[model samples]
Target chain A: MSDKRGSRAADRTEAIMRTALELGEEIGYAKLSIEAVATRAGVGKHTVYRRWSSKGALFLDSLLSLNEAHLDYPDTGDVIADLRQQIHAAINLLDRAPVGPLYRALIGEALLNPQVAAALNDHFITPQAEKTVARLKAARDQGQLSPDFDLDLAMGILSGPLYFQALIIQKPLTHEYVDRVIDALFTGMGPRP
Target chain B: MSDKRGSRAADRTEAIMRTALELGEEIGYAKLSIEAVATRAGVGKHTVYRRWSSKGALFLDSLLSLNEAHLDYPDTGDVIADLRQQIHAAINLLDRAPVGPLYRALIGEALLNPQVAAALNDHFITPQAEKTVARLKAARDQGQLSPDFDLDLAMGILSGPLYFQALIIQKPLTHEYVDRVIDALFTGMGPRP
Candidate 1:
C-alpha cells in the first residue's frame, strides 16, 4: 500500500516535469513559473512547492529530463560505429525544439548561476561526455586504437563538431555532416601527399 | 557645410556605438536601453533613432563595431598562421566584459526576431563560417589537407573544439587548449601507433 502511493507520487512528479518542459518551449525560460507549471499540469501549487523549493531547481530538473543530456550509451561492437551512433544521437537530440534554445540559455545562464551550472554539468553534460570516453577506453582495452593517444582528446574530437553545429551554427545537424567529420577526424588532417 | 555636418554625424555615430558597447557591460543587455546609451554618449535620442530604428539594431551594430568583425580577414601565406592569428584575436576580443554576454544575447535575440536572425546569419555567422571554409580550400589547394574533405565537415572539425572550450567550458581559449586542438586535429583523433 505504501509503495503504491510513492510510485504514484513519482508518476505525478514526472508528469509535472513533462508539463514544465512543454511550458518552457511555449514560453521562454525567463517566463516559466511554478504556478504556471502546476496549473498546466493540473496540480496544486503546493504540490509543486513541496517537490521543488525553488523555480531554478524546478527548471533544472525539468530541463535535465527534456534535454536528453545523459543520452544512451551506444554499444555497437565496432568502435567507429559506436562513435557514429553517438554523433547521430547528438544530431537527433538537437532536433528537439526545446533542446537548442534551452541549451543556449542554459550555457549563458550557467555563466552567472553556479548552482544551476553545477547541476547541469554533473547530471547532464559531463555524463554524456564521459560515456564516449568510457567507450573509447573499452576500445583501447581491445587494442583497437593506438596506445599513445589521449582518450580525452579523442572524445573532444568526436564531440567538438556536434557542439559547434548546435551552439554556433544554430541549424539542424545532419547525418551526412556527421559521417564526414568522423571520417576526417579518424583519417588525419596532415599533409596527404 | 554639409560635409562638416556629415563628419560630425559619423563621429557621433561612432561615439554612440562605443558607448553602447561599454554600457552593455556595466549594466547588461536585459537592462540596456538606447536612451541610456545616448545619455552616456552625450548624444540626443533623435540622433540614435535616426541611425538605428530600435535598441536591438543599435546593439547589433555596436557589437559589430566592437568586435570589428569587418577586419577578421587575414591574408597570411599560411592558413594555419592566419587561423592562429584569428584565435588569438578572439581571445583578445573575449577579454572585454560585455563581448561574451552581449554576443550571446544578440544571438539569443536573433532566435526570437526573424529579421535579426536573418541579419545575424547573413552578416555575421555565415560570413565568419565561410571565411574559415575559404581558408580550408586554400589549404586543400596547397596540398595541406586531403582532397576528399567536405568543407562543412572540415569547418566543424577545426572550429568545434575551439567553440566548445570557449562556450561550454566558459574558460578562456588558452594557448594550451588552442595548440592541443590544432595539433590533435592536424594528426586526426585516433592514436598514431
Candidate 2:
C-alpha cells in the first residue's frame, strides 16, 4: 500500500491496541472483547479485523508491543553488585501496580491459551532471556562466575524466587525477599570466591 | 425437610459437581457450562442450583472434593528427610496429567474471577499452608532446623522453587529440580556442610 495508508493503519492499530490494553486492565482477560476495543479506539470494526483476526491476537499484540522494557544492567564490572542492583530493580518493578498486574494476568492467561502462550514465549520471553543471557555471559567473561556456570541454571536461580513471590506467595513483592534471595543466590550458591 | 428429599438433594449435588469436574477437564475453565453438567448428571438444572449457586462454585466443589486430603506423614525422626520426602511426593502429584492441568486451570481461572479466587485461597492454599506449618513445626520441635528460622520463610525456601519449575519452566515436574532445591534448603545459607 501507499506510505500514507501504511502510516494511517499504524496509527489505527496503535489506537486499538491502547484501548484493548485499557479494557484488559479494567475488566480482566476473560471479559476482554475486540468490539469493545474497536468502539473505544473509534475505528471501524472491519479496519480492526483487517489487522488482527481475534481478541486473543489483538491482546497478544498489545502485550508484546508494550513500551515498558525491563531494567537493563549497566555492567559496573562487579557481578555480585550488579546482581544486587538488578534484584532491587526487580523489586521496584514488581511493586509497581501497572507492571505487576499486567504481568500476572499475561502469565495466567498464557498458561491456558496456546496461541497466546506461543506468542508470549517467542516474542516476549526470548528478548528478555537474551538480555539476561548477555548479562550472565558478561559475568562469565569477566571470570566473576565459575567457568562452568550454566546460563540456564543461572536463569533458574535468579528468576525462581521472583516468580515464587508473584505466583505462590501472592503478597506484596517486598524488597526484603529480594535481599534474602539475592544474598542467598550470589554468596551462598555460586562458587567460593 | 423429609430425610428422603434431603438425601436425594445431597446425591444430586454430588452428581452435578462430579460431572462439572469431568467436563471442566474435557473442555476447559473458559468453556465450562452449568447446563452441560446438569445434562450429564441426569439431574434437573435447578437441582444444581439447590446446592451450588453457579458454574464456578459447582466446579470448585467438584475439584475441591477430589484428592482433597493432604499427604499423611508419619512422625519420622529425621525432619530433613521427611521434608524432602514431602517435596518428592508433591512432584509425584504434579506428574499426573489430570491433577496438574486441572490445578493450573483452577488457579488461572481464579486469578480472573474474584469469587473463584476467594474460594481457591480459602479452600486450597490456606489449608495446605496450615499442613505445611504443622510439618515444619514438628521439624522445629525435633531439633532439626535452625532455632531462629521462620516457618513461612523455611517453607518458601523448600517449596517455592518447585512451583517455579512447574509453572514458569512449564516442564514436567522433574526429580532433579526437586532434589536440588531440597539439598540447598537443608544446607542453609551458612556453610558447605
Q: A1-193, model 1: which lDDT tens digit per residue?
A: 9999999999999999998878878887778889999999999999999977666678767766754643666766777787777667766665566666765566556655656566666656677767877887888778766565566666457777877676556666788778778878766776653
lDDT of 2 by residue, A71-165 (tens): 56658887667776766775575456665676677778767876666666565555667777898788777766655545655555566767766
CAPRI verdict (incorrect, acceptable, medium, high) for model 1:
acceptable
Cα shift from native, residue B37, model 1 (Å)? 2.0
Clashing pairs in 2: none
Q: State the lDDT at A71 in candidate 2.
A: 55
Q: Candidate 2 lDDT, tens digit per residue, B1-193?
A: 6999989877777777778878877887678887888888998888777766666677666876664543444457776566667666665664567767877776676655667776765665567677777876776676665555556554455556666567655666677767665555454333232
- Top of the candidates by DockQ: 1
**Positional deviation of residue A167's Cα in model 1 after best superposition, in angstroms:** 3.3
* Per-candidate fnat, comma-separated: 0.54, 0.15
Q: Candidate 1 residues B1-193, lDDT tens each?
A: 9999999989999999999988888888878898999999998899899988777788877877766663375866776667777767765665345587777676556555566666666666677777878877888898877677667676578777776666555556676777677767776655564
TM-score of chain A of each: 0.81, 0.78
TM-score of each: 0.83, 0.72
